[model samples]
Target: MLDTFQVAKARHTLGLRQAGEAFKHVISESDFNEAYNEIRTWSGYAPTPLLQLPALAQSTNVEKIFYKHEGSRFGLGSFKALGGAYAAANVIREKISTRVGHDISISKITSPEYADLAAKITLVTATDGNHGRSVAWGARRLGSPCRIYIHAEVSSSRAQAMRDLGAEVIRVMGDYDASVAATRREAQAYGWTIVSDTSWTGYIDIPRQVMAGYGVMAREICETMKTPPSHVFLQGGVGGLAAAVAAYFRQAWRDASPHVVVVEPELAPCLFESAENGKATQTKIVTETLMAGLSCGEPSQLAWHILAEEASDFLTIPESLVGPAVRLMARPLAGDTAIEAGESGIAGLAGFVTSALQAKLREKIQITEASRILLIGSEGITDPEIYTNILDEN
Candidate 1:
């Protein structure tokens, strides 16, 4: 099931040098806790289960693999629910406070008294699928208007999901990056506050909130683990999730421990490109792949800042490997439970699987037979038709 991998020279030197002062600007437990407290207020909120895959370990030559299944995170079907929803809520709260020239706590913002006030504000974001659904769902829950812009690459099913949540879904031409750019243009003309997870110069606050919301997952992961894994292969989208989780590990783990490896599709390896360039670099992506969630062409600036030094490596795998990874996760081995990982959801596994096949990479990343691996299945079968079609393949 392995395919060609586009390996980049990793910036492996890592330590806790920035963990105190510089990282303070990135985020902290209090930031994550604030998001977690808000997320727990949701009706059916609970910690997602972390499943072990010993079969995968045997196959990849790793000691063990712990897959954090985010498929059922409040039934939104992705870890994005944490970021998108929390960003939408926080945006409205900030706007409400700004309008009244008074401090507005999140508790009061969630109360029934502010339902009318919440309905008046609008939150906007651009997503491939999961983030859009989460944003729209959050807006609906808070009685606010949410406008989601989807690029041509996004599935109609995903756009419909946002529509189902009462979001004004706008379809734009080109790729996800184009949709993001178009969303910015639309935001300027329409006057909606952008709650994007990706950040720019002036718009770091909402994205910071989004990234902080994602930190709750890391918080949960840390709480569940007595011993940390040797390697963590995280999906690299705009780098929001990777940086959020990496921020936690940077603070939690000791120097040179828990080597963080970011996994992205070779076609759209924004983080990999950025890491190589030593800054936030934009990718000139053309075609789309099944791993739509990580189909970003640019890294988030704030996320890049956190991950540039925190992450030990970056790996890019072929698109062909994604289907196999999904099947591998879906068909559990022995005592392992089946996990329905979507296209992008299985990217880290794909990267790890491909990387583990190569002896040099194993040596370079220090992935020995005793190394424990951790990966986040960031979504479930968000697109059932694609999932079915892929599973139907050999």
Candidate 2:
């Protein structure tokens, strides 16, 4: 059995390997400009609001606290759309170009002549909930098929949402990791290209494309802020979202970038252990947490690399604090500024709060009133019953 230190070392090494490979793409300033411009061209909705959490800031000792509110993302109530849609577009464009022996951008590939090509293309992925929905939405818009493999634990509402978007939803028994395996198997069997955000061996491109899409979020946040926060707390599952933000910030501000902290549930601290050990490692124990989105057992190789290189630290929070963080956000504050954040969405703030409440964390991190913190509310009301009814029960 690998010791904790050994596990972390393994993760760090794996992260380095993946980062070296991802750097090949390099995502130049022009790539970001192209991605942002292309994303605007394929838009279905307005940009999500970036709101200041004045109440939360005042409640905490931190000097500033901001929330990148993705709750309103394309009416899907999650930021997954940014990645999922871009992956679909990338795949569609690639397929069309391969057939016609010429390059076709997302804009040019949507014409009537390519209608048959779109119908033949299918996007496949595995998700706890949000990412799959975003892919399904994109597929529907692009006139393609989508197959979403979801763990059994995912709520009916979420599955139905994907189905509503015309995705063929497959319920896989077991956990999120198992669902990913199931999706991979089906994708291979059917020759359907997988557009997963997580990367394994021989499956790097689509995931990288997905990460590129997520870069839009960081770009938006940086552009919107007058003076970006000194620290950002990002929730981590397989670390795709955290990695995307970290990589973009690493490039956007270079060495002057804010401290990028990846927050994970203590139950599944693969990235945390990976960061500590220096190579990618998987947790032997299965995770059981209210934040389903953060219940990944293994770190994606691509995301692992980005976090290892860019993130300043990894913070692990216990499962119990997830609920309190949700409640705290929902409570009316400063008259009319209550935040209705989902469990996974509030995990970053919860980690911060837990750190503040812990003497060791406070002393070690030097967290003080001068610290400026940023948290991402990645989803809103995904599981309203858990956030609402459970909080009411408490």
- Measured against the true structure, the TM-scores of the candidates, in listed sequence, are 0.93, 0.90
Cα lDDT of model 2 by residue, 1-394, tens digit: 1011111211111123233423224344655666677776665756677777665666656787878888888888788888888888888888989999999877777688898999999889898888898889878877899999998788887898889999999998888888989988888898998889789887887877777777788888888887767888899999889888877876777666777777888888888888767888898546467787888889989887667677766778776666567777777356325777888797787766666555566555567888888888898887666667757855
The C-alpha stretches of model 1 lying farther than 4 A from their native spots are: 1-22, 110-112
For model 1, residues 172-264, the per-residue Cα lDDT tens digits are 989988888888998899887787889988788888888888888887888898899999999998999988888877667656447888988
Candidate achieving the largest lDDT: 1
Candidate 1 colliding pairs: none
Report lDDT per candidate.
0.82, 0.76
Task: Tell me the deviation in Å of residue 313 in model 1.
Answer: 0.9
Q: What is candidate 1's TM-score against the reference? A: 0.93
